[model samples]
Target: MQPYSHARLRHSWLPLRPCPRLLPKESSNTSDAFDTLIESFAFPEKFDFVDIDLGRIRRAARAPQARQLTLHLAIRDAPAESPAAQALSDLDAASFKLFCTPVVNLFQRDATSIQLTSTDRAYPVTPEPLETGTPLDVYSIDAVRLGDRTQSEHEKGASSSTAAPRTAVLPYRALSHGRQPDPTVAYWTAFRDPYAAAGNARAPILLSLIGLDGGSAQVRHPQIDVDVTATNGDLPSRLPIGAPDSDLVHEGAALACPIRLLTQPTLPCSHARGHGALWRVVAGLSLHPFDLTQTGLKAFKDFLRLHAPRTNIVAQRSIDAIVGLDHQPAMKWMSLDGQFPSFVRGIEIVVSLEESALRDVTLHLFARTLDRFFAPYAPTNSYVQLIIRSSQAGQELHRCPARSGTRPVI
Candidate 1:
């Protein structure tokens, strides 16, 4: 994983959209504490960027009792070894985007700072905000680069301009802060099937609770019969659900299909609202179910049926043998930097074998490759027709005119 960082912007980063957050009940003590925390910590300069949406600020008002707030900002397709490396990665030069979300009350505070029990790391929290400061902690970061096939066109008349960034001030209310019995037990048990295991299963799927209440927490690994739960000392009754992980996949035949992994976090008591981001991941295995094999077979069948309908050897033993041995093309995800969304990364296709294995190498391969190639100048309303021929005496190759709706031959 390579560390990547966003370039420091001189302005804020929030777009002019309606922020969706609820405000907390106001109290003099809570306001004083929050204001003091904001001022003392100087959070804006400390964080690479901040979101100051009014709704987020209002939501934080509910966390008056919260001593500290833990933030996890997720940047897609950007992975780094450390914060310093992440800061040096040329995120500005790459085609990518930075999406930041807030996580509330993930730490316990001693007297002067916030602490994490699991990692045994403490972060300093002051009563005043710093004008220019360093980040106290670096949470987890994961990124995926999208690909673009049309490089020549992509380079033609390219523009390197961008809009200014923005920041938002979110008031993350103290949600539930206790531990509960691992409710993921049932989910984990379902992952234990031998058939599912044979399918390259994703085990121990997690479903965590997240919301405005400080609630009990739990961990259940049903596949192995393990359960662990914990709770906060002071406000045990009013806590919310646990934090959730990404969805568990039953890898196998599903890998050959176009599928998306969606993570739905634990909901609030209201059943309508919650405090978590739904992370979407593109899932595929390299050389497992052979999605490309399936695609190639389909395309070969099309060529045989549509282009060569009179051929009687389509189902012969040799055809089957070739199909059995043929390898699928390779596909990869890439980034041109800030171009397409997560769903639209650049796609690359590679051809390895010679077209001679089938019929005519040059003509067929050219036609297929051209049809598959990504280009800005792709014909909008035209089609390509290919033909192959073999000659023993001719020393030169030449294209011969063919009648309308007929394949061309040399």
Candidate 2:
């Protein structure tokens, strides 16, 4: 309703110059070469990371030789403190240094993994071309990370057993926007069942920092609001808030995004911004992950489709605006074969498309299919209703247990 200058910073996957390289012809062990290159880089002494996000590698099997090294660098943007003021401060732009220790969590054990931190920051970043020759040899040392899991009791339990406490770190791959929550959920999904056996189904207890991107550094701000003048509710507040090894907050607040919050549960997703009517439509499907009803069915199918993107009947361009998913998974269950996803418990859409399952699918197969005809990547999209029976607005939905018990799913 209102267009406010939401606080935001200029973030970019800096493409450094003089990229370091080792010709395959020059070395037999590219792994060793990778180690040597990532162990440390002569980054510009002036520009250091306010924060950094290790992103996924854009690996093109077609062109394996030249892999794009993508990394996120946070600019020093503080409220009231203009770029000119930051230049005058002690840690000014002219002579910046990155503190690599606590900002990232890289859980990899290979050539691709390099020891990084405030004191032992590594990665040979250069502006100019450092290596010559294609068919080059490059070794990925480890998985890159961006969020800090040290605070997450569950994530801590999962990581602490094998490695030392890790800070948030993104992988050395190029990413335009930060990692969304779905990927983060998928990230946690990789852990052994016991880790999440206790409290994994609920929203993850992660210290999501990047979610607070735009807004004053002194005080946190919300991304979207029904009316800021009347209710200054921030959508990002739904994310867990705390100060554990962070430069922002009480000084440099978090920089969060609205889109990233959609992946989490409706509690934070809706309460954070105080937009229940709005998010209920977007996040209603999230309620289905562990259940099997209404929007949940669509969510199940969406998760399945996420695993195999090719089989999705809904056009990629139209998914976010997907109309309410059919309460019943198409009983025919044509494409899925017999297998179902394991992350969620219950009937695998729990209504598994058996003849009985068709009972559910038949309800909205045609309408769900018709939803695809509407608008696109732009805003002002159509709304998909939830299958839940709650006729009242701004109310929470409840359902029965999604599955019988925890059984090993292949």
* TM values, all candidates: 0.14, 0.17
User: For model 2, how does the per-residue alpha-carbon lDDT over 1-410 read when each residue is reduced to its tens digit?
Assistant: 22223233333322121222221122342322122222211111111223333222222122345444423335443223332334445543445334422111111121212222333212321111113311111122223343332333334356557554433333222242355522222110011122432342322111111223321122122110010001111222345543345323332337642221112221111112233533443443332232334555565445433322232222232233323333332212221223453332112111222221121122122122222211121122112122222222212222221212222233
Model 2's alpha-carbon lDDT is: 0.26
Alpha-carbon RMSD of each model: 29.7, 26.2
Candidate 2: C-alpha RMSD after superposition: 26.2
lDDT of 1 by residue, 1-410 (tens): 22223433232432111222122223433322223222112222122233544345334445544544443345543235423235546445343324544222122211211122333221222211122341121111011111133322343366544322111111223222235633321111111122322242222222222223323222221111111221121222233333253222234564543322221221111011123211100011111212334465544433322211122242222123223213222222322233342232121222222222333122322223222212211122212222222222212122222111111222
Candidate 1 C-alpha error for residue 341, in Å: 15
Residue 243 error for model 1, in Å? Answer: 84
lDDT of 1: 0.25
Location of the lowest summed lDDT over 10 successive residues in candidate 1:
277-286
TM-score between candidate 1 and the true structure: 0.14
Cα lDDT for residue 304, candidate 1: 25
Rate residue 214 of model 1 by lDDT.
Answer: 28
